[model samples]
Target chain A: MQLARKLAAKLVTGLVMIWVVATATFFLVLEMPGNPALAQEAADMQHGMSPAQAASATAVMFGFVPKQPLPDQYRHYLWQLLHFNLGVSIAEEGVPVSHIVASAAPWTVILASFGIIFSFLIGVTLGILTAIRRTTRLADGLTLLGAFINGVPVFVIAIMLVFVFATILAIFPQGGTVSVLETPGWNAGYLGSLVVHAVLPVACYTLAGLGAWQLTSKSSVITVLGDDFILAAELRGLRPLTLARYVARNAMLPLFTILAISFGLMFSGAVFIEEVFNYPGLGELLIASITTKDFPVLDGAFLLIIVAVILANILADLAYPLIDPRIRRS
Target chain B: MTRLARQPGPDPAGSAAAVEAAPDSVLAPDRGALGDGDAAVRVRDLTVSFPTADGPLPAVAGVSLDLARSHITGLVGESGSGKSTLALTLLNAVPPPGHVDGGSVTIEGVGDVLALHGADLRKMRGAEIGYVFQASQNSLNPLKPVGKQLLDLGRSHGERDQRVLLRRARALFDEMGMDAARVLASYQHELSGGMRQRVGIAFALLLNAHVVILDEPTTALDMLTQALVLEIIRKVHATRHLTTLVISHDVGVIGDLADRMAVMYAGRIVEEGPTVQVLAGPRHPYTRGLLTAMPRIAGDVSEARPLPGRPPDLASIPRQGCVFRPRCPLATRACAEAEPPVTVTGEHRFACFVAAQEVS
Candidate 1:
């Protein structure tokens, strides 16, 4: 009963958060200086159209806001949001904002999820190893490596990877998610090309995030190692593997919260990473809509990001009790 | 794991009988008269040292003693007096930076413990010698249920029948007066302080180790709980026919629970005797001072004389002469020249130059 209540509370908070973001985005998008309709009209006139024709074209193309009062527009936007309907994109005339987001969301989610999972796994494993062998030269070397990779910007790493692996060596594809030669089906060739294209962007994501996980997990494991329970376990004559399990399990508790937050933040990083690789993820869509002043699509994408983050946090809260028994009682 | 308890522990008949009797009759007065060959564990000139910036300084200086078979020996000392280190040496698990540099700990059935390493060392720890750590209330895996941790212990030691191991653990929990099913299913935080301490004992004895060490078993407990824990330790020790070592700073605790008492000053054992005899007539100045300092209900409150000078840390301990001479009211020029030699009188032994001369 309590679990259901907690989940209900979290969901309500999530809805409120979405409403706040939607309201803020509506006002903020409209408040931007220089009208998009006037800009579109000027561009249309430059194409040798008459002033009347340019105005008509601009009215038809840039229909981001309808002719209505501010309060009515907000009410209409809220009503549309309630029905999960983000109106048509202004830039990509006649394309629904939902349809555009639906196509792009998967790419970003897949890239970031794989990157986060791989980085978290590798980092935590190495962290446990280094913590146990902290005084050794190899551990010290790994610490240095983690710090170095973490210090470099994700884009810089992405650019360097491109230069070295794609440009200089010609070992991998330079850009795009898949080759045009391959059909988008359940064939091996298509899937292989997809993986090949995701390699550099994912590598950038993993390398950029790996260091923080490694260092945090290392310190966490070290602290757990000093705990009296560890000594007690040792006294109980637990095998080396069993001892490592105890240390790793306890150390990973605090890192779970960090992992969830990292999952949410990965999209923010996707903006740069997806651009560098030219992968058509939400980040790419966001950039394209922003450049063209597609306010509807932009607002929809922002709302999607906010919802994704809220869902991740909610999942973490629900999963915490399962991992830590101490939380179950309280 | 249960097979460990089946091994003959000193005198089976006497120990079995002691189990059924009251706590007071658990330790027969004349058991201290037992010969050295009858000892369950013997430590000879044990010196544990820690490396300092200057050099390796001895934390537990050449201390020799014996734990009589199926006897509860109490080691009393102030903080940093090396009592805990001495107990740890029996398991050959002195914390790193400090190690057993000299002496040997020999259990009757097993060979020298200090020489054992890796698998041999590990097997000796829980299988042969059980250790209840100081503040054992907190010495549990916070993430795991008590039962899961018990299973982990069983798996580690290659116990073929998990059912048997668990049965023995539940039996121990029952004996310790806990709701076995609920406690086994619960985490450390779920149990109260007394319950956790009892669980600590259950874990120690779960493997049926014959040689058990309880380091400050009642340190963090309330007065009533401390009494209860002490009673539990006494009952458990008697029933198991175990050779036990209890280390505490409280003289009252030692006087109440110990069959044999050894007083440690700094890193060395300054006095050793049967509990009754030692409490009656303490030969060492430090032991007498410690007894005097203890507050009592029956005695005049002002008569309780606090021992002068604070206890010394590893670096602050004097290198020459007797370790206790600086704080001794009867210190002489002769006490400053060299370390005191052990003077034996019947079952009691003390290291004091002035006391030895006075006895003569």
Candidate 2:
């Protein structure tokens, strides 16, 4: 019953966070220099409409009315969102924002999940090794390497990887999610090509994220190593495997919190990585919406990102008590 | 069991010689000569040192001690006096920044701990010796259930069957006077301080080790809890027939629980004898000072005078003289010229030039 209450509290907090983000995104997007109607006017003018014609067309586009009041617009947007309607995209003309978001969200989720998991696995392994062999020369060298990799920005690493593997070596494809000719499916050929295309972007994410996991795990392992329990375990004459398991399990507790926060971050944080690769992910969609002043699409993309973050945070909160028993008592 | 009265002034050399001739008179009544099986642990000339930036800092100088079987030998000293270091050496598991420089710790029926390595050392630690760390709460893995931690210790020591391990843990907790089911399900933090300490002791006991080393077991407990824990320790010591080394700065604790006691000063044993005899008529000045410093309820209401100076730094202890001479109230020119010789009277032995002579 207490667990249920704790979980309910977490869910409510997450929902409130998403609501706040939605409201803030609405106001921030609307407050941008040019309104969507004005952007529509500019686009129509570019298509050879006279200024008066473009203005009248935009007026008609708004249902023969000028812009609504801020409160009315907010109510309209919220009502539309309640009915699962994200409206039609202005930039892509007739494409529903929901459809666009649905297509792009999968790619982002897949890439970030793979990147985070693989980096976490590799980083934790290396981190445990370094912590165990802390004073050794090899561990010192690894520490220096981790610091170097962490210091460099993700985009820079992405660009450098592109230069080395794509441009200079001409080995992998430079950018894009998949080949234009191939049909998207679970079949071997399509999936293989998809993986090939994801290589660079995923590599960028992994390399960029590896350092934080390694550093965090290293510090955590070091801290647990100092714990008296560890000494007691050692004194008990536990074998190397048992000792390692005990140490690693305890050390991973702090990392769970980091993992939760990082999972939330990966949604929006993928923007630069997606842009660098031109991957058809939510990040690219958000960037495209911003450039063309597609407010509906922008709002939908922001909402998806914010919701992903909230959901990840909730999952973390739920998993915390399971991993750390002390939490359950309090 | 006539109580030996506290002696005043000095004794003649002839009496000291006569006492040394019949050493067993001061030995524990149940113990015979120091046979291989009689002494559960025998540490001889054990020296441990830490490597600092400047040079080697000796934490435990060449100190020797014998722990008789099924008896509690309390090693009492102020912090940094190498009490904890000496305890760690029993398992040959001195933590980093410190290493066993010289000496041998031999457990009867087990090989020399200092010389053993790899599997041999591990086996020795598993089957022969156990340790209870000073900080009781942190001495347990906070993330694991107490029972699971105990079970893991048992498993590593070759207890393979899960049911057997669980039963053993439950029995040990029961032995510790805790609710077996509740304690088994609880994490370290869920248990109170005293409970945690008892569980920590239970962890050590799970191995069924013949020798248990507890470092400052009652240092942080409330008076009642401390007394209870001490009682439990004494009971455990008696019931298990286990040679026990209890290290603490609390002389009162040692006085209460130990059958024999050794007082450490600046990395060396300053005084050692039967607990009652040593507390009643301490032969070494440092031991006398420690006894005086202890707060008493029955004595006159006088201020407890703490030892004046801090312990000598391990890095720069004087090499040519008695380490305690600088702080000694009875220090003379001879005390600074060389290390004091061990003076023996019956089972009691002390390292002091003046105290030995004056007391004798």
Candidate 3:
């Protein structure tokens, strides 16, 4: 019953978000600021326009289209959103917003997916390690470095990595998802190149992420340390490795909850991070669409990212019960 | 776990000679007339301290007690009385920031428990001295089922196979009058608090340690469960001849299970005696006060009198003085300058400048 209520609430929240985005798209594109048609018209002028067509274009650019009311236009836009009809790009003529986004979504997903997953994995692992070896010199040093690295912004890390690897040391490409000469494909060769390009960004971001991720396990460690079972386990006098593993396993319960949140945050957070590395991810495409007033394309990317994050959070909530039995009974 | 209680403890040579000459060692009331029978644990002048901004403050101050074979000794004190600190000291689990300033915990065969470091101490802790903590629920792992956890416990001690440990775990469950398979398969959360306590008991006892520090084991258990657990402990103590230290604030609990009891206040043992004797006629003013303080449904109304004033703060206790002097009503000028020497009887012992007057 609680799950049903939670899902129903999420559905309502998602629809409310869609409505707001659609309304914002309508006002900002049609009512406010610069003309969407102006960019199209400028391109059209170079190609040559008939007098009637030019006048019609100029009037539309300055809001002459009263044929379709604002509500009707909003409805049309919402419908287009539902049907995956992200309209043409204003920056590049004859280019559809959906098509540009579609071509670039995978790159972003790949970069962000790898980056987030890798960051979470590495971060959670280090956190657990540091938490377990809490008193050791190694753990102390790891905690110190993780805090320092994570304290710095992602862009700073990205730029620094770029300077060291791409500029001064030229070990990897300066920016971009794949090499300029390379054609992106599903094959291993292309995927391998993409990964190679992704390594520094993943490492750079994951380092910052590790501070929070691993710190999660610290609580788990403390919890495990307090567990009477450990004392009992100690009484049973097991090997050092077994005792450590027992502590780690019990501690892993809460870390799972932290992992879910880290996954969501890192994925969405990769947007700016993607642009910084010049990776052709959805974030970069969304920026391009926004600059040219391509509302449909921009809205699609915005809505998708928002929905992705919310869904991830929801999934995390739903999954917590399965991982820790104590939650389900509650 | 080495069997400290394997051989029956004999009388001292003088007592043995007297018994041989008079045929009364078997009926002798003075167990102390006998020599020490390889004290299962000998904690000598133990002082455990925790660091603060000012300095390291002693939590357990010069607590010297012997836990002998086939005996149940109860450590009785209210919270912050340093009973738990003393217990932790015996286990050698005083974490970082806490230091054992001066003490030696000598367990038979295991040697100095406080001195033993790394793997040596770890080995002794589980195999030799089994421990039961207060919170039974959180004491066991939640995710892992009871059986697997038990199996792993055994596996840690070189019993690696699931089948072998599974059999042992089932045997233990059956022995505890619980369903072997159900308890084995059930997770920690699935069981009730009492059931978890039972599992805890099985875990501690199955390993067969001579000394088990049950730090308020039944504190969180229900009344019926407490009775059942106490009964089980008595049964185990009798059958295994285990040396048990049951720490509790409930004097009734100590009276019920302990052969001898030690009363702690401000990290010092104010009184120690046979449970029945202490309850019936306490020698220390604090002990008498504790007895009088216990709420009664059937006792004479005039006899009930609660002990006034709280226990002293061990952190800033006077360097040369009785720890209980601040609260001890009968304390004289002599109590302020030095701790009174322990007064001894056949088996009972009391530490108070006014012990002479508190007793008959």
Candidate 4:
């Protein structure tokens, strides 16, 4: 009953957060100088229509032009959102914003999931090893390496990796999710292309994320190692494996929440990584919509990312009690 | 029972004076010549030291003791007196930056405990000598249930039949007057202080370790709880027929529970005798001062005077002569010149120049 109440509270808070973000983005996007109607007006004027004709034509074509009052536009947008109707993209000429977002969401999710999972595994393992062998020179070297990797920006690493592997070595493809010629299906050939295409972006994500996890986990384990319970465990003559389990489980508690939040961040997409690799993920879609002044698609994309982040936070809060009973008691 | 002479030559200046007066010094007690033959554990010339910025300083300096079979030996001292360090040395587990400089801890069935390493040392710790650490509340893993930790302990010791091990644990908890199943299901935080202390004792004896040590078992408990826990300890120690050592700073706790008691000051045992004899007639000035300072039920509350001067830490402890010379009311020029010798009288032994001369 307590758990159910806690989860319900977190979910309600998450909904409130989504609404706040949507309202803020709504006003902020409208306040920007350009809109799809203006861009259309410019295009029609370039086609030799008079200014008056283009303005009237835009007004007729786009029923909800920027000229409409702010309150009415807001009410209409909220009504559409409530009905789960992200209206058709003005830039895409009748493609629904929701359809565009749905199509683009999967690529980013898979990439981020792979990156976060792989980094978490490698970081946690290395962190444990480093903490156990803390006094040794090798552990010191690993600490220094983790710090260095953490200090360097992700884009720098991505560019260097692209330059070395794709540009110079010519070992992997430079851009795109898959070859244009391959029939997209569950066939071996198609699947192989997908894996090959994903390698660099995934590698970039892992490399970018690995350092922070290693550093956090290393310090966390070191702290637990000094706990009085650990000393008591040692006195009990516990086997190395059993002792490691106690240390690892306790050390992993703080990291679990961070991992969930990182998973949430996956929807926002790694703009630099996706851009560098020319990967057709949500980040690329977001950038395209932004450049074209496609207000509907941009709003839809923002809403999708915000909802994912909020939901992930709720999941983390709910799952905490399962792993740590100390939290459950409170 | 065995007698331990302070090992000589820790300091060059003090060694010459000590050697010259060796015959009349009364420092050396006849080794294994006058006490009980069946000692469960014999500690000989044990000296543990810790490294500091200046140099290595002894925490448990040149100490020797015996835990007679099936008897509770209480070691009493202020914090930092090294009574706890001496207990850890019995298990050969002095924390790092501090180590056993020299010692031989011999148990009945097991040879020199300090010599055992790796698996042998580990096996001996929880199997032969169970240690109930100070602040039993913090000694338990916070995350795991008590039952899970018990199973971990059993598995670590290569116990093939976990069922038997758990049955022993449950029985031990039951004997300690707890609802065994409920306690086993609960985490450390779920239990009260007294309950945790009892659990500590239960864990110590669960593996059938005949030799048990409880370090400040009732330190943080309320007076009523302390009395109850002390009773439980007495009951458990009796039923198990276990050789036990209880370490505490509170003289009242030791006076109430221990059969034999040793008084420690600055990493040295200043006095050792039957608990009743020592309480009734303490020889060393520090022990006398401690007894005088204790708040007794019968005595005038105003008569209790806290010992003058703080207890000496490793850095502050004197380099030569008696460690208690500065605080001793009967200090003389002779007392400041060299260390006092051990003056043995039947089962009681003490190291004090004035006390020995007075006895003579």
Candidate with the greatest TM-score versus the true structure: 4
Model 4, runs deviating above 4 Å: A1-3, A42-63, B1-25, B29-36
Show model 1 residue runs off by greater than 4 Å: A41-63, A66-69, B1-34, B135-137
* Poorest lDDT segment (10 consecutive residues) of candidate 1 chain B: B23-32
For residues B1-360, what per-residue lDDT tens digits would candidate 1 score against the true structure?
A: 343444433443234334553222212222223364557887777899999986999989888787888889999999999998898888898998798888777776666788889998887778888889765446888999999899988888888687998899889988888899999998999887788889888988887788899989888889888988998999999998888989999999999999999999889998898999899999999999999998888989999999999999888888999888889999999888898877767778788988887777
Give lDDT per model, in order: 0.84, 0.81, 0.72, 0.84
For candidate 2, what is the TM-score? 0.91
lDDT of 2 at A42: 87
* lDDT tens per residue, model 2, A1-330: 987897899888887887788899989998877677776788899999998888778755542222557898788888878788877777776678899999998899888989999899999888988898999999999998888999999889999999999999988899998887788888787888899999999989999989888988999999999988778878878877888888888899989888888888776878989999999898999899898888889999999878877888888888888898887767
Cα RMSD (Å) per model?
Answer: 5.7, 6.3, 5.1, 5.0
Pick by DockQ: 1 or 3, better one: 1
Calculate DockQ per candidate and list them. 0.60, 0.56, 0.51, 0.65
DockQ of 4: 0.65
Interface root-mean-square deviation, candidate 2: 1.4
Q: Candidate 2: deviation at residue A141, Å?
A: 1.0
Q: For model 3, report DockQ.
A: 0.51
Ranking according to DockQ, highest score first: 4, 1, 2, 3
CAPRI grade of model 3: medium
Ten-residue stretch with the least lDDT total in model 4 chain B = B1-10
Per residue, candidate 2 scores C-alpha lDDT tens digits across B276-353 of: 889888988899889888777977647677777877777667778889887789899989998886776666778887
Question: Between the candidate structures 2 and 3, which one is better when assessed by lDDT?
Answer: 2
Pairs of residues clashing in candidate 3: A127-A214, A229-B139, A235-B126, A238-B156
- Which is the winner by TM-score between candidate 1 and candidate 3? 1
